[model samples]
Target chain A: MSTGGGEAEFEAALREAFERRGREAPAAAGLLEAVLARRRRQTRHRVAGAAVATALVAAGTLLGAQLLRGGEPAGPAAGVPAPGIFAAEEIELCLLPGGGDPAEVLLSAEVGGEEVQTAISEPAGDAFRLHVERAPGYTVRLDVLRGSVAGEPLDGARDVRAGDRPGRIGDAPGGGRVLLLETGTEGVLLRLTAEGTGPGDAELLAWAAKITVSTGRDACES
Target chain B: MEFDDYVLTRGDALLRFAHVLCNDAQRAEDLVQEALVRCHRRWRRIEHGGLDAYVRKAILRQYLSWRRRRSAEEGPAGDLPCAGGAPDQGIEAIGERDAMWRLLAGLPRRQRAVLVLRYYEDLPDAEIAGLLNCSAATVRVHAARGLARLRRHPELTGRAEVVEDA
Candidate 1:
């Protein structure tokens, strides 16, 4: 069947088809409840998984230390390191805010030491994912979000400074290090994650220091 | 606006939009639900404005990146029954619409997305490009190719011409 009218007629038919199909959609009853329930379940699973992983890491560390010390019994606090000097694993970072519109990068930073490509994945959202060639397969993600840093993993984080901004340094899950810093803007927090087996904490901190978080109109100005 | 309140008010519309995007009711609901969950998480930041657009973008992203769904090689499925149409519509028109639907389902995901956004959503090429993360030229290319393929389909070629003549 040839529509002598051509493209315009075909488009009209297509639009009508879409409208008809759209109207047949089922009612979205209980969708909000389902979403909330799924979110809660996911949170529970993450928390439980983190707890198990942390326990195993702590126990393994204690056992290894004991074995190294000629089978001497390790004390309760033996495996736990000071806040500033955490094992390169066992820290869990909080999830960044979702649904942020991708914004243009108003500021940029240089990553010293490693041959890394720094990109602002969502500059408006203040999130950056740095692909460090030195680490081969690992990615370093830095997310800046509004509000002070408050979460489960911050319990043992030690205070540090990135540039002039105050921040905290701690171990991150999967053999990585996390640096949480306060940006120049009051109430905005920045999180830098050097994935496991990637750059050392010192290098990560150095890279963090190079970042300049500006208080532009957007949440992630820099 | 509160997250729950927003969902209550606009959930059906979002679901409908998702349905048009993916051409599957169940998958559409899943997309909307996932987008809403993300929206709920960041409602505090997005609630100030453009909340609907953000959620719609989230849904579109999820639909585009959902690689685990049906393979691209799969054949286009038959269209679901249209709920309502013109009172005087005839069988030929219905057949034409069904053919169009099947042909649409056969197009590449991005092309289908471009067509839907252009015709159904009535969005500009630039806006569709933004949602799809491509240039406006690419959007037009997709739309052109998709429409070309649909018009060329053996099923719609004759029926579409007849409809146009009518």
Candidate 2:
């Protein structure tokens, strides 16, 4: 696939495509910055905590506990410039159980206004096949990790199941695990593995979710 | 990644990819911007793994899916006029590239995905198979069909479509 003429032509095509985009990339910074600002909630939360602790420490030695408080789990001051990304921590998910085969529910994330849906399959023993892709219709930025389902409903999803929260995930036909969590505003579908029984199926979900995109150094340390 | 850091890093590539996918320069910028914001809110996890890969796939899928549904329900995209054949130049022009874009748009999501992964990202069939939900056989099929469709475009000529020669 790398003959001389072929390589030249390919280079030309790629070059043309790149040039065409060069004209439009200028405004992208503003848009990306705005989006990141929204996610900066975590950073804001941390800074705020530090500010509060500092003020308290000044107020009295009673709260000087701030000095020895581990200082918000320090990391390198900032990210290196070239990686084109910085990150905080991976999403941490806590499972609530519902009973049945857990194959039905999956975890989801969105990227670039697109939906990235993920489901864990028990195609065999102990090993899980991850199904990740974009879904149609509503757009999302899926930052997904680990997934499971339980035999019965999870306490949070079940207790709050009736009110403002609508159930986006349902048990699979012939019944399935049905544990769902509304983490903040994001939704997660948990299911059981192959021969899957009720909700709260696997332990992998917690570990996987935390292994988010390799953008943030802070998240990596955790 | 932190919101600021995400912008710092991915702004350019995501912007470029989104531009190609959406056609409208401004809209691509908007879509990428919006996506990143959402990603940031969920940055804890989204920034991990093959983040670039995940982000690229997500953007294209969202762009294509939205385009598909919009075409079905709305009058027209207005900005996205149906892209059609133009002569192949010795060096690809902006217009010729746009024509290739249209051809890519014609492919099924999986086929398009295979071509993008195999040809663009240069991911192997196994990896492409993992990316899209199908067997390696399915990846091969998609690649074959995707190439065939590209070949059918009159502008592609003997140059673009010759796989072995490529």
Candidate 3:
């Protein structure tokens, strides 16, 4: 996995994957246009204090510079929205391994944002997110349970000042960095910034603290 | 790099990238059309900077930055086109390719883009850094992690990327 000197085999394999995907997936002029339209309208986060790419990225899905105050995500909140309501037809969710079972889960939501999208995936999946981004910039991601500071359950979840002060969240008691982040649909954001850490390290810690996961329910669709 | 020329020349590449990111045809078109309009809006600034490169950077970044809409986001009645078997399955192995995309859809954003630029777009680390606004090392990290995961994929078993030991 070393991104070192000329590795044709590795590079070729990468190309092959995309080529294979392109051929398998239907290709049309309009599909490209949809991506264009979406990308054009998406917003960018203004990054401060170098060391990372501070782009807000895609609508309400903005990346923040906050460090995980420290801890893991709280246990699933009860009386939460059904996983089905979260599922969308056209949208697919790629669940990467952050020390969890089903190593990787690739799921598609049903589109309406009312139903939850669900699907199982093989373990040993890698890191990368390839899918359409259509969520608005101002969404209040209401997860019944856990969402680490690293995770973006609530769209953008930043920009607007938090009406309620930031507090602690995590299920496993006694000092984990998990907290149930809550914000209105107006782009209230939460970010975990691991001070004096690299992006990868920070991301790992963040995932540990905040990864929206479903341990009990296998699959659901509304 | 004028807006007019970009639409004419690099539009195809943009469309192609959009298609890959989205895995759907019609949606890809709408994405590009919107990207084109935005590019045209900033045509003057882009021409001075580097039209194709700017548009490309913007497009890729935009793709990453936009709010992710799930299939559910499409109206209750309207669904994002579902993936179906291609008619030309005989000509091309559709399932295999779909498997690859399915695999890709599982990854996080930065890793996906890094892989796209390094392998698909064939841009070096420095250029990728320029595009992603990160250090060269970060780009290398992303490329490495992304490739490692790709190699682990079974379909990619004989694709010539995985080392025997790897």
Pick by TM-score: which candidate is best? 1
Ranking by TM-score: 1, 3, 2
Show the lowest summed lDDT stretch of 10 residues, model 2 chain A.
A78-87
- For model 1, the stretches where C-alpha displacement exceeds 4 angstroms are A1-5, A53-222, B71-94
| Docking band of candidate 2 | incorrect
Per-prediction TM-score, please?
0.56, 0.42, 0.45
Model 2: residue B109 alpha-carbon error in angstroms: 3.5
Candidate 3 lDDT by residue in tens digits, B57-146: 766644664233332112111123424244456433455555567777777778888887776678899999998889999998987887
- Every prediction: chain A TM-score: 0.40, 0.25, 0.20
Q: Taking the tens digit of each residue's C-alpha lDDT, what string does model 3 give over A1-222? A: 334432665565558666655544433334434444444444221123111222212111221223332243322331122122222212233433334322334444333312243333432222122222222321122222123344533322222211132333332232222223332212222222211111222222222222232322222111
Q: What digit string (tens of lDDT, one per residue) describes model 1 on residues A1-222?
A: 343556677777778788888887756677777777767775687588557645644444543444333466543334223122122222212222334432322222212211122334354434443222233445566565555755526434666654455677677545466778875555556777765355544445544554544333323311
Docking class of 3: incorrect
Model 2 lDDT tens row, B1-166:
5556656776676766665445455466556654555455556767476677666655655554422323321111123221222334455454566666676677776676566566545679997777665799989998887766766667654335443253
User: For every model in order, what is the number of clashing pairs?
Assistant: 8, 48, 105
Q: Which of 2 and 3 is ahead in lDDT?
A: 3
Instruction: State the interface C-alpha RMSD of candidate 3.
Output: 7.4
Q: What TM-score does model 1 achieve against the real structure?
A: 0.56
Interface DockQ of each model = 0.23, 0.15, 0.15
Q: Is candidate 1 or candidate 3 better by TM-score?
A: 1
Instruction: Give the number of the best model, judged by DockQ.
Output: 1
